[model samples]
Target chain A: MITKLAYKNILGNGWRSLINIFILSLVLTGMIWMQGLYDGWSRIARRQMQEWEFAGGHYAHQDYDKYDSFSLDKSFAAVPPKLQDLIDTGDAVPILYSAGIIYPHGRLTPVVIKGIPAEQNILRIPTTHLRIQDPDTQILPVLIGRQMAKSINVVKGDILTMRWKEVNGAYNAYDIQIVQIMDTPVPSTDMGQIWIDYDKLNEVKALKNSCSVIVLKNQAASTYVGSPWNFVSIDQSMKGVDAMIQTKRVGGYVFFVLLLFLAMIAVFDAQMLAVFKRRKEIGTLIALGMTKRQIIGLFTMEGTMYMLLGSVLTATLGLPLFFYFGFQGFPIPQQMSDFNIAGASEPIRCYYSPIMILSTFMIVMAVTVFASWLPSSKIARMKATYALLGKV
Target chain B: MRKLLILTLLISVSVGMVFAITAEDILMNIDKNMTAKTTWSSSRMIISTRRATRTLSSVNYSKGNDISYSEYTAPAKEKGTKMLKMKDNLWLYDPSTDRVIQISGNMLKQSVMGSDLSYEDFMDDLELLESYTAILDNDITYDNRKCYKLILTAKTSGLSYFKRILYVDKERMIPLYQELYAKSGIKLKTMKLSDVRKVGNRWYPMHIVFKDELKAGSGTTIINDDIEFNISIPDYYFSKAILKK
Candidate 1:
């Protein structure tokens, strides 16, 4: 009986009830869309980082600190025998890095020279471009990222002079040719970086079989340890991005809560108005032998029914919008390509997991019901005689 | 017999005059007039930027071309700063942090104390005669003094400047002007020395100006206020421990 009356009353009010339901539906859709986009962005970013830069993780010399360019001189050692076996089996790729200065068009800019195997398939870097076996040309072949090339003002087939300190503390300089300009998402591996063949760099430095860090294919397959070399796990390597996502997630929650609060206010206001304006109807129902507690229960059910209808409205309207967006991913801005933010340069495809959708639905519904009940509970405090006379 | 002997003597004298001044002879004379076995000097470096000018005073000690140390004595903020250069290594001591950091790699290319000179320039200990092959180009008048224009080319691949043009005073064997060039023949920097004085048997320039062509504004001027050559500077002065004092 209460359900029939609540349904009739909601339909009877028409536009007022529609407004409440519409606001609630809009809030639900916005929350779902925001969460899906955030998830998509973070997923792409983590994948790019793993594929292009970290590569499961790394085993680095103890003094090999990426932040300290000064440490690059002392951060190299001969590849350990255990790690060497992994390299031979194609499970690892050794990388040697040193600080260098390059003069492109006679302008001096600092660079980090990274040497990796030209034939290795360990990392996603396009190292095959460095495999030009030219015996007659003294120009060393090098690969640079697009951003680095733009900043240094050099393109493929351009020859520039590069200067660096050898392992013996002697300086060496020579001309290098830009063979490729890579397009990669990770800026740490791209900006201010130069890629060369590992063997050639070793020959130039006169330090055979030495590397700054060794990248592994599988993080969990080895437990290698030594005095000067230590392993960094994948989670440890990506901790910064994880923390950044966590902070953004907290901000998303605050925004969702604010949206929920606005929708709840509309429901609460409608319930308060119903109790005030429908006193004569309440008196008539009581006069017709309905108990006062039953009258309160009816009013409460009326208020809760708005949320039930709002949820149905949200599903009918939001699912189609979500599907449309899911098919056509959001376009990333062109300027975002210059940012150091990983994966932001790529289009974000919305990811709507069942768990994320279900939880969001439950949380919004609970808030809506609670918002209805708070105002309807006032019926219990009012005197029945005063309520019947519509005197509050 | 007297006529034949005189004719042979004249021929020998003419030949000796023709082969007298080689590139090595001029370079050795310039090196002798430029450096001492050990020296102590009080100097001031004045750097001028577009915004303002800063003057720094220091007491410098050096042995040959390799080991040198300098402690900033003025401009209160830089008073306790010290630098020690031994061979290819350079260490800077900052009193505020009480930390000694070795300047290496790319850091060597940065300017020293916002001056036109880089730490690499400060740590460069290569003697011109040992690192380059000099050729006598011509004689030119520079700064109202007759100068021998000599061109020096790097003997190896990795020297900072691949070629340099130097003008040495004909009488004093002191360099009056120099132009440094990169491997691509780009003019990188230029130095002009003046205020020549006779100290002992050698003539030295008391004032020098170094200009970095890559930058704007006026160049850096280094004035040797008081200098004592071939003095007894103890070996401990060049040690890293002296930086703390």
Candidate 2:
């Protein structure tokens, strides 16, 4: 019965209820949009990293430290015999890293030369371009990314000289012909890096069947772990990316809290004013044998009804806008893409998952009900005679 | 007439033979002129880059060619920084950290105090003839003085530079110009020596400039304000314990 009364009261209130519903719906829509951006970005970052660099995970030589560039030369170890089977079967790819200097147009710049198999399909890296008719050609065929090409100012088919130290400390130099310029979003794979065939690099480096890292085709391939080869899981590799997103989400939370607070405040104020002006109605309800608790419930239900209606309005009006972002994606500005963070180069497609939407709705609805009940709870202390006279 | 021509030709040939020196002899003299048993010096380094220029003053002490110690005394930010070198090992003491850290392996290649000079450059104390085999090229005139161009190739694998082209003053036996090269035949650095002065019985360069080709800058210039060759330095100065003290 109290619910029926609350519904009728909400309708009769007209414009006041409409204002409250509009504010609630607006806040909900904004909250969901902000959440969709973060979710979409995180998802895209991990997916791209997995596709381009870490297919399943990495099995790196024990001495390899990404932060320590000096460790590159000594980081390689002989591939364990068991893992070699995976390599032969095309379920894994071995990579070698060498610290080298490139002379582009006779200007020197330090670069890390990574050697992968030309026929490897384990990762999205364009190693097929590294395939050459004769590996023993005096000029080595190399691949570089767009960012590196821009920084070094080189184009496809440009021949540059590269120098590196052998395992025994002898230095060698060769002419490298740029075969392909890749457009990769991952900065670690693109910037200050070059790609060449694995066999060619090993032959020049004079190391047989050795690699700095082995990229597995799937998580199940991690069983081939051996001494001097440590398996790095996908979660471990993505820790840095997760921390970055968490930091950004913390800043976004403050704005969301404020928006929700304003919506709740509007409902709270309206509830307080309604209780003040409707003293005669409260008295009439008491005289008509409706308990004071029932009267409070009626007011509380009215506030909740506003939220319920807002949710309905959000579903009807916000669907098209969500769909637009879902389809077209939000383009990242050019300035932001240069931040060196992975996945910033690509557009972020907003993903509104059911769980994310439902949780947001529940949290907002709870806050609204609490705001409505706080002001209405005062009726429990009022005397029937005093309320009839409209005395506070 | 034939007898007179033969006599004149013999005299000319004899003069050329008497004046010419072997590459080994030239290298030995250069070593003798540059290396001292012990030396103490106060010098200033002016490091210049495209963005800015920084000047640092330091006191240096060396024993033989293997042991050396230096402490920066000027430039408030760099003051109290000390470095000690013992053969292939190098240790740096920073006043801010109050700790001593050993720079080893590939870390030695890092620039010192943001200058074009690397820590490996400091630890490279082997005599030129000891590390490189000298080959004499044709004579050339530099700075209005006769100079012998000697191309030095490294005899070992682990040296910082694989080859060097040195221009040695014929009379003073001091290197006036040098070009350091990598094994790939690319010029990596150039050093110019000037302000030649006789200190005691040996000739020395009071001013030197070193340019790192891989870096973008005008390079570093070192000026010796005061120098004492063959002076006895305290034993404690070269000790690792002095790094913290």
Candidate 3:
């Protein structure tokens, strides 16, 4: 009976309750999405570093620091070409990064230039629905992010040009058509990013058969660093992402937490006000000898229902995107050329973790239900004589 | 006998010319100094759109000499990836292998971390006298500095970057500006080093600019804020093990 009464109360303030529900829905969805973004960033960096065979380890904080006297030419000179072969036989896949401006369609923004093998890129790269086929034409066929479409406002068929300085002091330009503007598993990759064949880049730079990183598959995968390869491991290469993900997660959490907090506050406030407005109605129930426990049960049931409905609506709208990320991943922006946090690699894909789901639900329920408790308990404390007289 | 004596005198004259310049000739005499060697230790904060990493390093070298060595402190992201240098040689220590390895060949031409110069092509400060014939092109003025524009052509057929025109300050003989050309005679890259400052007993160019003429893509300008030289630097600091250290 108390539950029915609570339901009628929520319906009486229908429009306001709906606005509150919508706000709560956004909060819940955002909380899940923020976590999603974090997982996506890590997953992409980890996988790409492994797949691309970035020369350094994925998690290790390897510093390729050049001091004041260190010249650009000498920094490249510091890491010799012979070390790659020695490290390749080990557990890591090292890749070097190059950042430059492209000139395919009238100079796109600066992009992350990933120097990697086409076949091996699958390991660390988040899965985009599009298949990027290397084209054999005067225009270099390139792999780009989905955000390339948005930033430059370009589409799939547009021909974009890429530029690089040749060793002989000439600028080399490749007028490549975008073969794929695929979705990356992570949103951060949605900018203007391009993946050129590393060998081709070397040919242009006049440095053939050499890369700068040993992106590892595991921490203990390789231990022999000479002759064939010399590099840090996968865990070693996440130097860029550790703090990055933490900060991003913190921001994401704060946004949703504050949002959810406000929604709960509003609910708690309204429910308390509703008790006073319905004081006379409560007094009548008390005079009829309705137990205090019964009244509290009614209110608790009503609060649970509201939470359930809101959660259902949020999940209904959100789960499909989650499943899509699990299956057909989203594409990143083309401009996000340097997505390798700590030199890991690009195209990190975040999958659904059961733990994340479980915790999110718990937090959402706990906040909403806990906020309803104090107000309902206050109503339970009233004396029957005062309650019937409507004076308490 | 006269001819033999004459030839002997000429040989002596050439040999003496090689070692004639003293530290006094190269230092403290010029009205404006151009470039010098410097040693530095610093930390870098790199921020991408969503990520940030800090890297620390100690570096040493002479500017005009064309080579320097740096010891890298691993970034939070790339731990166990070692970076090292000795003369022209570079090494990246791989903790996975526990071995100090040598960096060699083709990897040299790349711009270091997107810097203005190719880390591979410029290291060895190729002995100008040995690799090319340096001809005095003309005396000109650049940025109000009295300068000599020099044309350097490879003595051998296979030297990288077939020709270079350097606008060097006459007084300091520092190549203040340089234009590099390809075998096709196409202008390829331009470099300008300026903002000279004295660090220790020697004066050095505190700024460097590298622009790639060919790509029309991207370039770098290095501005050195603080500099020192010869801080009791140890030769062992240039070793491979130190790269990972």
Candidate 4:
């Protein structure tokens, strides 16, 4: 009998129920979208971070960088010679680099050029980043990011100039072939980066002996260490990249909350008015043999039925948006992508996170229950005569 | 017969004193020689798995300050370059643009060519005797050199390498082998010194071999190809204006 009454009240207002359901679904759609974005961004950031950390991210020490003390000393070549024998004898990633300065064609600015050999567009740098590819070299030389390449006005086939400077304030530039350009991965990297091939750079710098950094990876079972004037990290040095990746992720989380919060305010207002309009009816029920629990249950069930209808409509509207973006993300403005935002190196790709979507629906149910709480509890507390008679 | 016996005993005593030199005394002599500020020229080669790369440079090194000037050459490229360091300031000049720019401290973290050397490793001039006290650890043969195994403990913190055990040569007063230890008491690296040569009345290390503790199979070897010592170099070459490249 109670369930029958609950069903009647749900459709009691005819088209009014449709209006309420539409408003609630719209609010829910916003909440789901925002929540999905945040969760998606977080997963992408973590995956990318893991890749970089495994690639010697921990070796890029920021604390030690403050000393203003790094240079190539032609006098201290104590460690370079036997490096080849060890690489051949042991299993080690051929982590190598060569540094030089280059002035891109048309752009006269001489920039610090670097050539990194190996995979280019993966964890650390995303693919949408434009780089000039080398046509001839089997080893693809990369062009640095859009902003840097534009500033230097370098396409492909431009000659890069390298100058070896000594402590005596004298230096001479060596000409290097420009095979590729690399994008400045982050704002920090963008501020100081140029491009060339690793082999060509080694030749020009005459640094078959000098490499600025080494990135190495080998099978896990094959390693060991000694007196380290070096360092180790918590995420194994994942934090350096994490700090940058975090900037792009925070947006999605906040947007989720914004969507749900706005919907909640509207829900609260709608319920308040609905409950007030039904006061006379509630008063009569309380005056009769209906106990306070029965009155509260009646109003709560009616509100829940409306919410159930709202959720169905909301999910129908929301899933398609997710799939649309999952296939083809909304394009970010080129100008905005180029700007120096803290975490996002490139424009983001929007996608879905299953956990986020499920969690969001649960959250909406919780909010709907709370929104009904005030109205139902009031129904329980209504006075018999004043509530029913429409008293002044 | 009594006078002859006394003269013979005195001569024998003098010869014994001449042959016996304590490890501490030898270290003290090397420490003193290290104190003199001087200029020198050397060609160093970094030997790696990929290829051999070499740099020929003239250097002016000073004690207690990071002020030095190096005029380096790319023998392979027919190129010459100069760098100057005054205190903490560094600069390098681009002969192409004729422009000078300051180098950041981070560049030093890079490996010196294809070798096991860092930029800080190249500046390994401060002998432990000046900053730390040495104790004879034990006798050890390092790379076939008979050595007085000695342990050195730093009196101060923040040194480049804190705890080191050196296997010093018994005859030449040079460190034939060295073991570097971490703060946690783990051995970090092992280094061997070989090919000792005399330049201008003084003996200097001509070659060094280093092995990483973690990369057990891989190591670095550095050879100083050309060596000159006690040459004159200007002090002003070590300044901010000079480090710009």
* TM-scores for candidates 1 onward, in order: 0.77, 0.86, 0.46, 0.50
Worst 10 residues of 3 chain B by lDDT: B45-54
Mind giving the per-residue lDDT tens digits that candidate 1 earns over A251-297?
99898789889898988888778877887677677677777677767
Proportion of native contacts present in model 3: 0.02
lDDT of 4 by residue, B136-195 (tens): 766787778787887876656545455788878776677888887643344556888888
- Please give, for residues B147-171, the per-residue lDDT of candidate 3 as tens digits: 7777877666546566778777665
Candidate with best DockQ: 2
Per-model RMSD to reference: 5.8, 4.2, 13.7, 19.0
The CAPRI class of candidate 4 is incorrect
Model 1 lDDT tens row, B37-74: 98788999999877789999999999999899999998
- In order of TM-score, best first, we have 2, 1, 4, 3
Q: Which sequence of candidate numbers ranks them by lDDT, best first?
A: 2, 1, 3, 4
Task: Determine which window of 10 residues in candidate 2 chain B has minimal summed lDDT.
Answer: B105-114
- Kindly give the number of clashing pairs for every candidate: 0, 0, 108, 47
Across B1-245, the per-residue lDDT of candidate 2 in tens digits comes to: 99999999999999999987889899999999999999899999998877799999999999999899999999999999999998777899999999999997556656788677777777777788788899999999988879999999989877767889999999999999999876667677799999999989999999999987756678899999989899989999999999889
Candidate 1 — which residues are off by over 4 angstroms? A248-254, A279-305, B1-106, B113-116, B125-196, B206-245
